[model samples]
Target: MKVIAYGASTSSTSINKALATYAANLIPGADVTVLDINDYPVPMFSEDKEKEIGQAEAAKAFLDAIATADALVISFAEHNGHYPAAYKNLFDWSTRIDQKVFKDIPAVYLATSPGPGGAQSVLAAAKGSAPFFGGNVKATVSVASFYDNFDLEKGQPTNSAVADEIKAAVAKLNA
Candidate 1:
């Protein structure tokens, strides 16, 4: 199976990215592509911007990635209990290019935060909005207290329970 994975954050040291990479690696036979939003940097989405220059190459590339994926694994980074500005910007621009960007693609939505809420609020928002964009929500997980529960240097989940949960989610996707 082909999977496209990404963390919806621009931070170079993002825990969300770590979690996404970890999860993507767990899927058996999954040819995974881990994306960095920085690679697709685009001006904030605005009708004025679109009218002025039309769609950017990065946006087109982003869409093409989604179109080719068999599944999507997104680990959202919550900023102020909502989607990060960078990810939201990408979503807006991609939607403008194609409203049904997800187009019924199976998706494993995830979120991570340093707090106990584990980005639950943003996950809820994504679950609520996913169907509108043609996403087939397959599974979800939230990693709380990311720094405490995961070892950044080791690049693995320090908490056994969290690791097992992530593994189980990956197994389900592979099945």
Candidate 2:
């Protein structure tokens, strides 16, 4: 399978990106592309800006990346119980080209944080709105206390139960 994975954040050292990459690699022999939101940056969305600039090339490129994917693995990084501004800006621009950003591809959604909440609020929002945006959500995983649960050197969950849970969720893509 060709899986497109990304963390919905612009941070250089994003823990969510690490979690996403680890989860995408679990899909036996799958080819994965991990995207950085910074590479596809767009101006903050506004109707007036849309009128002035028309459709953004960056947004189209973002959609093109998704078009090549057989499945999606996205890990959300919550900013105050919502999407980070950078990702939200990208999404706003991308929707102008195609409302269905995921293009009906099956997806595994994940979220992580160094706290008990595990960025669950944003994950829940993503899962809830996915279908409206043509995302076929197969499963969702949330890793709480990310530093405690994940091993950076090993690039996997340190907790066996969390690792198993991530594996089970990733497996659903082929189902």
Candidate 3:
């Protein structure tokens, strides 16, 4: 499978990115592309901006990247329990190019936080909205208290139960 993965954040050291990469690699023999939102920066979306600048190549490229994917691994980073501006801006512009932004791609939706809720609000939002934008969300995973649950050295969850949960989801994604 050709998989496109990304953390919906602009941070260079995004924990969601780390989690996304790890999960993407779990798919057996899949070729994965981990895209950085920083690379696809677009000016904040506004009707005025759209009228002035027209569609950007960056937004089209972002849409094309996922359009060609056999599957997707997306991890949303919660900013005030919502999508960060950068990703949301890209979404807005890209949707103008193609209403089905995800191109009907099957996906494993994930979220994480240093706190106990694990960014669940954002994950829930993505799960609910993804389908409207052509995302076939297959499963969801959330890592709560990320620092305590994930082991960077091992590149997996520290808790066996969490690990098993993630593994099962990854397996389903691969299936």
Candidate 1 structure quality by residue, lDDT tens digits, 1-175? 8989999999999889989988888888889999999999889888999999898778888999888888888899999999999889988889888888787888888899999999999999999999888888788999999988999888899999999998887776755
Tell me each candidate's TM-score.
0.95, 0.99, 0.96
The candidate with the higher TM-score, 2 or 3, is 2
- Model 3 root mean square deviation, Cα atoms: 1.1
Superposed by TM-score, candidate 2 places the C-alpha of residue 170 at a distance from the truth, in angstroms, of: 0.5
Candidate 3 residue runs with Cα over 4 Å from true position: none
Between candidates 2 and 3, the lDDT winner: 2
**Root-mean-square deviation of each candidate, in angstroms?**
1.1, 0.6, 1.1
The sequence of per-residue lDDT tens digits that candidate 3 reaches over residues 1-175 is 9999999989887889989999999899999999998898788888999999999789999998998899899989998899998888998999988989988788999999889999999999999988789988888999999989998777777898888877787787756
Model 2, range 26-80, lDDT digits (tens) per residue? 9998999999989997998999999999998899999999999999999999999
lDDT score, candidate 2: 0.95
Every candidate's lDDT: 0.89, 0.95, 0.89
Off by over 4 Å in 2: none
Error of 1 at 127 (Å): 1.0
Per-model clash counts, in order, read 1, 0, 0
